[model samples]
Target: MKIAVITKTIITSFGLLILLAPQRTHAQLVPQPWVSVGGKDGDVTYSVGARALNWGAELGFGPDSATGFDLLKFLSLPVVSPYLGLGYYSEDKGLAVSGGVQVGAGDNLFLGVGYNSVRGINGQLGIKF
Candidate 1:
């Protein structure tokens, strides 16, 4: 009987702690949209992408038109956030691999440079809310 009472009290205390603790919203669910322009073999490629929760999806328009999806892993850093991603592109572009470092330009703006297997070296500009 004593053990049962103690268990109930502990559970109540934990529940109260959980209820009173600060609540954090998952901001990573908000997508960060970016535009990129790149060149390969004298042809220009334009692409747009959005990232959320360490995942990204992109659509490319230009010579090598394709749709791609990527899983992004970000490194914890001070000024710059560097990421590496592995993806697959449609339209015969095959496997896509990319790496980039993004630097915050201002409060809500970021700039990046990355290289994609199908898109070549690209510059990225994005905004985060």
Candidate 2:
């Protein structure tokens, strides 16, 4: 199906980006923690995650509970960090694919808009610490 192909492409791209990242000792230990609250369709969803280098993972809860892994730091824009993610949710729902742009509000705050295949359109307000 189309979704399967897209998912494969995303995973492949993430792997390529990770392999291309610079080798830095400090980057491996630094964790960027964040909290996100949003709505998918009519269901409320929230997540907490951490990013280190170009990789991140989140535990999410809502109409469905899921765990997601994202490739962060792929784009080097000044104020916005764009990311792509893939996740597996409970119930019969399978893979969830997502992409979003995060805009920094301060040193530790960000706002984002994203769409997930399983979650619908979502707007997020988060704090990174």
Candidate 3:
């Protein structure tokens, strides 16, 4: 248990350090690992990965929702990072929403659950610049 805590702390610290470090003029961006717990179409599904750049995506599976995939990234940032996500492989076909802060911290990650949402939880697993 202590080891796990320490590992998490170290990982978090590393992530924060990278986040706080000075930026390079042409440095590449990476994805951040993020996990979310929520429901879709009244069914539960959790996302467990992320990708960097404007061409990255995520993949995860759930019981009711089954296997799912998404292609989303920062498209617009007006006080919040707006993204375009397309989800499929669920009972209700798929969902399309394009007005959420899908990029960066301080943004809600647990926005979908127990409702008519597509992704119950989606993790941002890397950075992109």
* Residue 9 CA displacement from its true place in model 3, Å: 45
How far in Å is the alpha carbon of 120 misplaced in model 3? Answer: 4.8
Instruction: Identify the superior model by TM-score, candidate 1 or candidate 2.
Output: 1
Residues 1-129, candidate 3: write the lDDT tens digits: 999999989856654553444434432255545555555556666666554543335565655546667665433333333344555655554653321344444443322212114554443333333
lDDT of 2 by residue, 1-129 (tens): 999999999877875664575645444355666766777667877776766665667666656564444334434356876777777777666777777777889987778777677666667676665
Cα-based TM-score, every candidate: 0.68, 0.66, 0.48
Q: Residue by residue across 7-91, what tens digits does model 1's lDDT show?
A: 9898566545533444234536788889999887888878788776545666665455666665555542456766666677788
Model 1 residue pairs with clashes: none
- What lDDT does the true structure give each of the candidates? 0.71, 0.66, 0.47
Q: lDDT score of model 2?
A: 0.66
Misplaced by over 4 Å in model 1 are: 1-29
TM-score-based ranking: 1, 2, 3
The clash number for model 1 is 0
Model 2, runs deviating above 4 Å: 1-29, 64-74
